[model samples]
Target: MMKNYITKEVLPFEGERRDLANVAREMFNRKMTNVAGGNISVKVTPDENFSYDEVIYEKGHDYLLMTPTFMSEAWYAKLNPSQILVIDLKNGKKLSGEGRLTREINMHEEAYKANPKIHVVYHSHALNCMFWATLGQDMPNLTEVTSVNVPLGKIKCLPYRTACTKELADLVYEELIKLGDKSEQNIFLLNSHGVLITDTDLHSATEVLETVEWNADIAYKQAIFKKLGIIENYQSCGNSLTI
Candidate 1:
């Protein structure tokens, strides 16, 4: 059942927040996520409009602006502005906006808490990404582009859990921490689910998402080459990735 905090209405957001929404629409259009898959969130501090969970998140600390679950729609449908739900992260409660907040709300919340410096998170059902997630494989930095900004070290994957549950959120938090400090984790794969990327903002997170998906796709193709004996004797640059 979809829960509502207020009447159905198209709410307006400021410039940066609006940019976040636009980027989300672009992410959707880019096939990073379908109507049913994927959610985007940004950490925001307490403001004049919201005043709950002050003690939990600290008066001036960051919370989240989570998109509500999209109802039945085509894959290419645009999400209205009213669909965005503001959440008080201290507790994943809907602070404003309408419609039900995403079932993955807890996942987004725990991710923010897992990394203090990560102010943005993008969880998407990007193709090729789901390939590695299901195969229990990790994304190795296979290119100079991915090797520098993204680490060659494997991005960890967690076991599957029912989405929108505390268990799922906890599993993500546990795996995300292995990437080192909260701020260092570039991306994580949720088993049989999707990819999650953390960054200082939406655009940066989007970049990481693109790079990670490319790496995932490349890694799979390389594995195919190995299987076909096309690169049976391939060697690496003294690393896990094959050449």
Candidate 2:
């Protein structure tokens, strides 16, 4: 069941809307997500007049706003308030707004439920983690960034399920719970899918996601070097592996 804390209302964000645009830009620049590959959302508290029913209102209601489906991150960041999809949290119904919501919307909701402290959720498929996940290899606790940011915990791998299916949502929820309080550890390697990152705010979450990709990239490059035996004493790179 979905949690109750996801009430609907016009969220008064702490930063300028342009900040969100910059975040999107940076993610694309860092290669965390491609044009239409990833999604980002932030939880906002509703205003005083926002009733539960008002929060639950369907797509046609007055307050619901969302970004267009499959739009490039660059294009998505340029969206106006009217261009965003707004809906009541009580029901999946669209209260008002014309934009189409992504099927992975439930993923965001599940993250919000798992940790109310998490205000931002980022979903992406980067090269490093994707390569490791495809090989069915577990991500090692590598650098200080990975250790302090992502931490050492079980990086749950979900089976190949169709995107946006209830089955996928349930599995993600289950994996998150299995992670316990460590869910904040950033970077979940979905078997054949991608990665999910949650943070107390968007900036931190974006940073963590970027770090996960960087670590994975470094590991991939180092592995190639080791296999070739190009250089000895590669252990100095801060790999968790011991010679």
Candidate 3:
């Protein structure tokens, strides 16, 4: 059942679609995620043509503008605005687009429903971040930049659950609910998987992702330095050195 809803009706949020594509390219180029690693999405209120699912999408929830499935493997970084899928978040139907919706759609929906203020959900399998994920440990606040920039207190790692499953989505939803309404940002590491980020907008989400990845890189280096017994020697030398 290959479903494609190429529509003549003007797609609702053309500007948002363009931004999504551009951001996708930027992230790909930056190596924030690999070709087949992750997904991004934004919550949006649909136009008059669509109606909210009163039961599932309570409080006027509507649609999602998200990166389509296979935008990574089949399409790579060459995403176009036309490829961004418009999805009915309430009922999980394709509203308009030539591409199929991502299977992780449920993850984004649960994130949005858990907190109405969160407008973006960005997930990625960045290499440095995956280092910590592989170990199934929380990424400690490693860098001064992360401490100042990333609003989330601690980077929690969730237990491994199969990807694109309702169980995974529910797990994320429960974590988001725990963050409470006032929280502005969230970053989670899926055990032996990747990172999930939520924020008020794409800009904030991507910014936090970049900073967190950088922090992860620094964390790796810090571990190496500590193991090599460089920290104590470097500290001792710093007291006598003049520059």
Candidate 4:
């Protein structure tokens, strides 16, 4: 069920709300996500608006400021600050904003539970990423920028699972636990679904998403060359992508 919190006629975290909306616009403009559905969230500290004892929000210091569900189908790139919703990280209840909560809320919540340091959780239906996702293959690190920015190595493609199901969310959480802060491997490609990127901040997360998508495009071209025999044993520049 969806829950709503009174903001005492005040909207808290105005700056964060604006930033999140801006990122959503940028993502839509870049085609990182589409009307098919995707979600972005940032862990935040609540203000006085959460001071009530009746609300579940006082249970935790952190909350999730997330893009609304159906954002793409309804508003697409025109998302505004008022559309971003606040969720209580501890109880998973909608705390503020008028927008409906995303069905993938569990994906972001479980991820935060797996690693408290993860501040941003970005899921997208990028065209190239979706290509690899539909193909059910992991995205190899063909671009040097990906190798440098995503040190955790190749973008893994998890087995297929129905979207918005606990099974899918749990699977993502398990993978995150396995990674466990050992490296920068924070990207996951959901089989037949989309891409998931996590990071300590929004900028870094979005930057890595762009880099990975670019690599995915390159991988697609590489596959075409292989099948067409255009390059006759074509191989990547093998570090030529480096400066």
Clashes of each: 0, 18, 0, 0
| Better-scoring candidate (TM-score), 1 or 4 | 4
Best-fitting candidate, scored by lDDT: 4
| Higher-scoring candidate on lDDT, 1 or 3 | 3
- Expressed as tens digits, the lDDT of each residue in 106-152 for candidate 2 is 87777666766666767777767788778766665466766664464
Top model number, TM-score: 4
Compute each candidate's TM-score over C-alphas: 0.80, 0.75, 0.84, 0.87
What local lDDT does model 2 show for residue 47? 40
Tens digit of lDDT per residue, candidate 4, span 12-131?
566898999999889888999888878999998655334332444442388889999888888885787878888878888887777899889988888888888899999999999999
Q: Score residue 144 of candidate 1 by CA lDDT.
A: 53
* lDDT score at residue 20, model 4, on the 0-100 scale: 94
Supply the TM-score for candidate 1: 0.80
lDDT of 4 at 228: 89
lDDT of 1 by residue, 1-243 (tens): 732232213332344556766787787777777656687888876433322233222346456776666622432425555556667677677666667776787787777777787788778888888888887666555755566655535666767787778998898777667655644447778787888887777787888888777877777787888889887533334455443
Model 2: CA > 4 A from native: 1-18, 50-67, 73-77, 96-98, 149-156, 230-243
Q: Please give the lDDT score for candidate 1.
A: 0.68
Alpha-carbon RMSD, candidate 4: 4.9
Which lDDT value does model 4 have at 223? 76
